[model samples]
Target: ILIGEKRFRQQSEDPRTSPSHQPEAGITPSPSPRPRSPDDLEEGEVEEVCEICTPPSDVLVVEGQVVEPFSTDHAQRLIGQIMVLNAQIDRMQEQIDSMRYRLDSMQQEMKNMIDVLGRI
Candidate 1:
């Protein structure tokens, strides 16, 4: 059917409300309740294709590997970097625990001084 044909539909059979069937243009209606992969919408071309054979600049070829810049770089970094960052996080947590313990000790010492002053 041609787009802008202006066919009024209803939820059941009334002519007032359109029940949202599909676009009149040839969009090829996706199957109902279909589980679609991330590669389905762009059709798994791996890299963006400008021409019939030309690839876009967002991807790169390094050591015979096609790497997507945004998707592959941060998501597929080396495990050594991840381990280093995790170690830093662990060290920061230990520092925080140490600071909390020191603060608690100082608070207790202040309480003891106040009690001694009250007795004198």
Candidate 2:
């Protein structure tokens, strides 16, 4: 089955409304499940396609290696990695905001010092 279809089936089978699906301490769950795109398919999960369906030009090559179709498990792993990267990006943005605030404060102090020196 397609990854999206599989995910739909799983979601239908296991509703998130159940207490068992609740987020645990220090763990934030995804706000909502997203449908998997064709790009999300991994190497092992690809089924054989007819010549007309997948032409030579449609093949995927990476690092001099041809990438085959992958399974749902690989797709899940990719999603997990994406989530981690997103979390890291959020943390970095927060740090950048904090640094900008401090820099602004320092600039204001320097302006005050220059004004005092001018008056002296």
Number of the top-ranking candidate, with lDDT as the measure: 2
Prediction 1 TM-score vs. true: 0.38
Write down the lDDT of every candidate, Cα atoms only: 0.54, 0.60
Q: In candidate 2, what are the lDDT values of residues 1-120, reduced to their tens digit?
A: 333221112222445446554334433222334445556767666643212222232234667667778989899999999999999999999999999999999999999999999999
> Residues 1-120, candidate 1, lDDT per residue (tens digit)?
111222233224545535463233433223234334455656443432222222232124468767566655575576668989999999999999999999999999999999999999
Candidate 2 whole-model C-alpha lDDT, 0 to 1: 0.60
Q: Flag clash pairs in model 1.
A: none
Worst window of 10 by summed lDDT in candidate 1 = 49-58
